[model samples]
Target chain A: MNINLTPGPSQLFYTVPDHARHAFKEGITSISHRSKTFESYFQKATEGLKELLGIPTDYFIFFTGSATEVWEKSIQNLVENSSMHLVNGAFSNRYFEIAKQLGKHAQKMDAPLGQNFSSIPITNYGTELIAITQNETSTGVSLTNDFIREVREKNSEALIVVDAVSSMPYPALDYSQIDSVFFSVQKGFGMPAGLGVWAVNPRCIEKAESLLARGISIGSYHNLPTLLLNALKNQTTETPNVLGIYLLSCVVEDFLRIGIKKIRQETDYKAAILYQALRAHPLMSAFVKDESAQSKTVIVADCGEHSIRISNYLSEHGFNPGEGYGEKKKSQLRFANFPAHSKEQYERMVDLIENLR
Target chain B: MNINLTPGPSQLFYTVPDHARHAFKEGITSISHRSKTFESYFQKATEGLKELLGIPTDYFIFFTGSATEVWEKSIQNLVENSSMHLVNGAFSNRYFEIAKQLGKHAQKMDAPLGQNFSSIPITNYGTELIAITQNETSTGVSLTNDFIREVREKNSEALIVVDAVSSMPYPALDYSQIDSVFFSVQKGFGMPAGLGVWAVNPRCIEKAESLLARGISIGSYHNLPTLLLNALKNQTTETPNVLGIYLLSCVVEDFLRIGIKKIRQETDYKAAILYQALRAHPLMSAFVKDESAQSKTVIVADCGEHSIRISNYLSEHGFNPGEGYGEKKKSQLRFANFPAHSKEQYERMVDLIENLR
Candidate 1:
């Protein structure tokens, strides 16, 4: 048996194959998107997500192709001229670039690799949107809840969009502090890649409508108004990833049954074990030196020149650790500690790291 | 045990369950998108599609959220100002609406519902694109290949775009005459929804680049150039529906093994039998008056006020025929003749329709 330790598209929860089998047996894959069955499935998913994430009553949930698409969609719908981004890694930087590519005046405050902002930056850039990635999968650096709250305090007028791509459920985010949060199911949700879930409060919706009323092209189909119109009827603007949505509902149900508090406890335990092992290892060290800034979901280690050998050792023993993102591909080994990844699996991983010579 | 005759999200091919089981067993769902395994899957799907569809070397294939999305992408990338649409049904009308929604000058030549154009319109409106739907799923009307060829002849300078959503592979389109063609996997391809395949020739690419150089927002992340840049490396712009892509490759392989010619032959035979039965029935008649223009893929019948009764009878007996789209819901019934629907199934459906009181 093989274990997937990559950040996104990580290991599937133990119940996934069985759920998929049930879905197929019920003709879930062959049903029409306009059917009552699909509507029930959509309802279950949206409600389950709201229950599990503690999403506000005023927030609306929408699905897109990927979290990357949300980067474009959020900018298109919310920002008419300018946006501000706080960048600490590759994924955050991509959001900034998307804003710029759409002809928005995008300004960014950056932090060095393996480090996170010590405090929220005060800016007078006249930005309409403020983008933040809660967890940087590239460097395994995450912002604390207090940091996000501070940012919100400083920029109360600008819409705050959070990228919770690799750090969700475990983050314990107060949704009341942000305007929008988006994540792909492949990451912490431990499902297949393809579906992006975006939760936005009424403020974002009002912004989109205001822009549309002013003759700014927010987008065409699948834009905020279109998605909202269909969503009110428990449908989508187009034929969405029905199977992905169904599976996500099932997974979220499982997570809720297990309880989020217990999941967070398990996550903290796993992160402590893995980080301790990395710090004590002879040839490896934790990439993020500040313990408070390091991500609990995606743990990265600075392997220096032994990245390949260490990854090979883990793979040979049935663990498939992910390489660093972009330029750090050869210098770091990243391990995902998603809800689907058991504590026993983390122990096995730590054993391998401890025995590495 | 149920027969799915609804146009899209219709029926899963018999091999799909077994293929999905194999996918689960092989851990295909948990693999990373950046891994070599994913690249191989991408390569296989693209190559399998090319071989099965006889797509030319100059045409580039890209995947999107849905065919509805391609309607927007094609217009965004290929047209700068104006587009002319040949509208006969709901799907065709939707394309024209999308173009108008994107702030383009969209013009249309309309035909009454359940009717098709007798001749291509002569236009010198300086249209940048001419859009046509080979098979309109909503009205069950299809344009002949001769009609498409005639349109190409009338407007040589305008890019020809075809929506082959419900009629792919069976139509055996001559790609040399068209600049771009797009389809969703749920219809003729007999897979789950959420994947849109867009194949564009080099001319379409050049058009997109020219628009981009002129500072048009053709889109940001999933724009043509960004998609092409990743396609060159056997990847997508974002974390795509990986399982959907894998399943499509498998289905295309199945088609190649059985041969497209044989599939087309079976489709023709089944359509003939169904249409004959509808013509002979006392309570039902063919919806499209013109025999030459009726679609072989989606066969529609005017059941008058007995539409629900016939559909109910079929559903109670294990077949689920589709209701008419939009305004025709009370008067018509639609049946799909995809590769997944066997000759035996079609015969069974015909027998039921003929004996209905």
Candidate 2:
């Protein structure tokens, strides 16, 4: 059997194939988005997500095309003039760029690759929104919960938007401190790569409405108000990825049955195995030097000049790993330790890494 | 088995289940979007669409969230100041609304709901783009190819965009006259929803670039330039509906193997049977009064006050007909006659409609 370790569309949960088969048998793909059947699927997914993530009752869940789309949507709906981003890696930087492209005054506080901020940066500019990525998928640098709280405390008037793209359900975020959080199902959710889930509080909604009321263009269809209107009926603003939503609901159900506590424990166990192997290996080292800042979900290793060879070696052994993203493609090897990836798989992978010449 | 006759997200083509099962076994869902496997899927879908739909070499195919999205994208990219639309029904009206929402000066010439125009309306406005819906899903009104040719003849400089949302491959459009065309895969393609295919000629590209050079906000992330740059690499602007693209490729291959000519013939046969039954039934009449303007793909029937009763009767017989859209819900029933739907099934449905007391 082939083992997948690539990030984002990384690994399928053990329950996906079976659930997909059941979906096909139940004619899930052929159902109308307006039908009651689809509404039930929508409700199950939203409720399952709320239960699994411990989301507060005041937060509303919405679905979009992808997390990338969410970046654009958030900028269009929430920011009328300016937004600030805490950028360290490729994904976070893209969010800042999206704001600039949408004609917003976007400012960023940058950290070098493989390093993360321990505290929120002070910005003198007036900002309508502040964006943060909890885990930098490209560099495996993670921001702590405390750092997020600090950011919230520092910028009380600005809406705080969190990108939990590569790390969610793993990070037990305090919903009361966050204004909005978004994620694509492909990464931490261990599902296919289509649907994006955005959980927004009343403040974000009010911000969007304020922009609309002031005659600022907050997009057309699938904007925050339209999404909220459809979501009230357990529907979407557009015809969505129905199959992807169904699979996500099934996977979240599986995650709930396995228990978040147990999943978090397994994640810690797997990360320890890989990090320990990195420390012991002669040719490899953890890319993130700060242990506290290292991402538990995605582990990046600096392999000097042997990154390609090691990735090839792992691939030959029925293990598929991600190469470094963007500029680091030749110098790093990334491994994803999602729920679908068991402790035994990580142990086997670590054994292979440690034995590499 | 239930027969799905909804306009979109309707019936699955027979080959989809087997292909989907194969996709699961091959680990298609777990592959990264940046990986070679995903690139191959993108190339196959693009090539298969070209072969099946007779798309010219000069056109570029791009994917988005839904056909509704293409409306917004087309307006954002191609229209600088104003656009004019040929509006007859709900879907076409939406395209006009999208343009207006994006701060464009949009104007429309309306025909009565169930009628078609034999000639293009003369617009004195210096329109940058002209939008046309070849088949209006809401009213089952189809513009003839000759009518489209007339519109092209009238507006030589304005970009011509055709919405082939519910009718494609069957329409056999003259590509030389159109600047852009878009469709959602769930309708005529008989796949799941969430994937929109936009085919653009070079004129549309140049228009977008011209707007960008002038410092206009042509939107961000999935704008025309970004989409074109990625299409050259067999990739997308974002993590797209990967599974939907894969299924569309498989279904297009099936269509190519079965031959478009044969599929068109079968579609015609199925439509003729349903239209004839509507003509004969005591309680039913063709919703589109003009036989020449009626859509062959989606057949809408005015069931007077018995719309719900007939819909229930059909559903009890394992046939799920689409309820009327918007305000017409109690007065109409819509039947889809795509390739996935067989002639025998249409005949059976027609017989039941005629025998209803």
- In order of appearance, the predictions have TM-scores of 0.99, 0.98
Runs in model 2 deviating more than 4 A are: A119-125, B123-125
Please give the lDDT score for candidate 1.
Answer: 0.90
Predicted chain A of candidate 1: TM-score: 0.98
Tens-digit lDDT track for model 2 on A26-142?
989988888898999899999999999998877899998999989999999999899999997999999999999988999999887889975445654468899989899999999
**True lDDT of residue A132, candidate 2:** 89
Tens digits of per-residue lDDT for model 2 on B1-357?
589998998898889989889988898888777778899999999989888888898899999999888998899899889999999799999999988888889999888878887544554446889999999998899988788787778788999999999998789999999999999988888887889999999999999999999988888988999999999999988888888888888898899999999999999999998898888888989999888999999889999889988999999998998988888888999888888788888888888887997
**CAPRI verdict (incorrect, acceptable, medium, high) for model 2:** high
Clashing pairs in model 1?
A: none
Model 1 root mean square deviation, Cα atoms: 1.1
Kept native contacts, as fractions per model, are 0.79, 0.79
Model 2 chain A weakest 10-residue run by lDDT: A117-126
Q: Deviation in angstroms for A260 in model 2?
A: 1.0
Q: Lowest-lDDT window of 10 residues in candidate 1 chain A?
A: A118-127
lDDT of 2 at B186: 84
